[model samples]
Target chain A: MTFFGLFLLFFKIGVFTFGGGYAMIPLFFDELVTGRGLLTQPEFANLLSLAQMTPGPVGMNAATYAGFRQLGVWGAVAGTLGVMAPSLTLVLLVGIFMNRFQTNTYVRAVLDGIRPGTIGLVAAAVIFFAESSILRAPLQSLWTGEGKFGISLFGAAAFCFTFMVSKYLKWNILWIFLVTGSVGAALGYWGLI
Target chain B: MKQFQRLWPLCWEFGKISAVTVGGGVAMIPLIEEAFVDKRKFLSEEEMLDVVAVTQSVPGIIAVNMAVLTGYRAAGIAGAFAAAAGAAVPPFAAIVLVAAFFAGLGGNRAVDGMFLGVRSAVTALIFLAAIKLYRQTIKTKFSFLVAVTAFVLLGIFRVDAVSVILGAGVVGVVWMLLCRRKQKESGGGQ
Candidate 1:
């Protein structure tokens, strides 16, 4: 029953939350906390942190964690498969259908509609994710550091600069990632951050 | 010509991509962009974004579709498979490794931190890509209405995105039919 529940929950998440992971995320929490009543507020917040700390997409990580939380090892497998199943199935099905529909004007318009929504979803996700890290800057400054903002200003600065370079200069993003990572590590070691 | 020869590099690239680029299609973007945009420069950013819009609206791994489109653009069907293979291989290997060493990896500090950065960036990449796509798709009032409707339905009502998409699709098809019918009726009178 637990495994079934986890599978169904994520299956629904995978199928419905179009605009991809970012758009699905706020809804992920809402479903986990409000719909399922599975996790506490603090725990939900912690999973957000954990999701960020995983290699895969946030939605996949969350499903994995939620699965683990619900059913241990088997639950994790069920959840991961469940989350992926929707996309795999939907995408493949759409792939087949789209091959025929590609040149259809109406199909183009429907997709055109979907494209912007994806951007909206991504925008919402960025805002939500950056909120804890960037939006809380003022609060952190007031509570944690009087003089300093307690935000990862350096991290943000590095992220923007590297983004610009990669965007315009066509610089190798991997190299920027390497340098910024090294700088971040150095800052951590030196107790500057 | 050397058309057939390009298939070799295409195979190796897609094969490698297929194996390694795990966590689904989105994860494949940066790597694809790295190869296509930075390395080959076959398609400009706008073209790639158009591809993405088409990829998402249609279905499949954006990465796989990208590989297919890109490979097809560069070489042919053979190129598509090669690109696909390159994209898929790593994740499959890592899945096995993860199965074996996941416990150790779970608690490691460095691994944890690396994941943290990767996650943050992946999330950022999705948003940034979306931002890029949005400007392209919203051309007129009807298109804008469809986007707004989709967002409200998904975000507010918490409607299933798939259903919303399908519903929009049906509405679009129906509207076109009705328009056609009315036009035919008017022309008969004329």
Candidate 2:
């Protein structure tokens, strides 16, 4: 896609995205991974992790990085501008008409509806990342009789370990990444993965 | 000149906050509270709470939204742009540098394995975020149904996420209108 196409794609993603950065994942997956075939699943997964680990909004990070990967620095600018454009415009409008919009029943109803839906969207994003990271293949592969259906033992272990620690131990996410990444590199050194 | 003078501080405050915070937009909340409310005293506590409410209400990245509202309050429209640029540019630059670095390191086994592990961890993080959001938003039966339907549509049916979101909003409005009509009918009968 051309730079303008990239900008428009991200702008659309920005307009629909609710909740937060995590909520944007499924949208990114659908538009970029499935629809456009611009990014592979693994590449998308990596982008998610990198976006999380980096500074600033995950949505912006993902957009800029993904755009950079697709085109160049200019692509990054396009994607960043595209994603932020909606927010800048909408927020300014809201700011100007804050009193009326604040008490608007229709706005509340739409938000209430959208809020729960975002949970589902984020959950779907989990499945998307799981297929790329933990599972050897997409879950559909089992029923479709395509591609090997299995789990990467290392990946599963890392996933569970990270989940439990973050849930119970309240370990910081970045520390978890550092520890798991180190172990993974060591394992790779021994040709385990 | 006065508005231009306010712009730098707004940009610097948001820029520093965004540059240092990891784990995305939500993680920056406390720091933003500290910078704007506690430290700078630019926004009162109540105003900050309102900022949070408005930011979450709007679509798109939460950090940028927060920056826009807070900056608008601080220095009008120009302040909003300055703060947003501050919030967005650091991540943009940082990710660009990291992406370029990784691209150069392509096919390196160690890097691949590290990402493999990190990717798995990322999945777990996203799952936790979903659970947290579920706890926050999914309270009533209608909400539960909406969540389930959205999950099934997007995950199983592979429907476009944008469509599901818009459809859910439409569903919500219709549900609310129907409930109101039912109340009106019942009251009239009484």
Give the number of the best model, judged by lDDT. Answer: 2
Interface RMSD of 2: 0.9
Which has the greatest DockQ? 2
Q: Candidate 2 lDDT, tens digit per residue, A67-159?
A: 998899989998999999888998888987887998998998888899999999999998899998899899788788899999999999999
Where does candidate 1 stray beyond 4 Å? A17-73, A87-110, A137-152, A171-177, A180-182, A185-193, B1-15, B22-55, B58-124, B145-190
Model 1, span A1-193: residue lDDT tens: 4788788878877765554445566556557865668875434544654543334345566666777767666777676667666545555444445456677877765554555555445554554444333333433245546555444565456546555765677555355555555565565555564
The lDDT, on a scale of 0 to 1, for candidate 2 is 0.89
- Report the lDDT of model 1 for residue B110: 51
In angstroms, give how far residue B64 of model 2 lies from its true place. 0.4
Error of 2 at A173 (Å): 1.3
Per-residue lDDT of A184 in model 2: 88
Standalone chain B TM-score for every prediction: 0.56, 0.95
Q: Which stretches of candidate 2 lie over 4 Å from their true place?
A: none
Q: How good is model 2 by TM-score?
A: 0.97
Point out the worst 10-residue segment of candidate 2 chain B by lDDT. Answer: B103-112
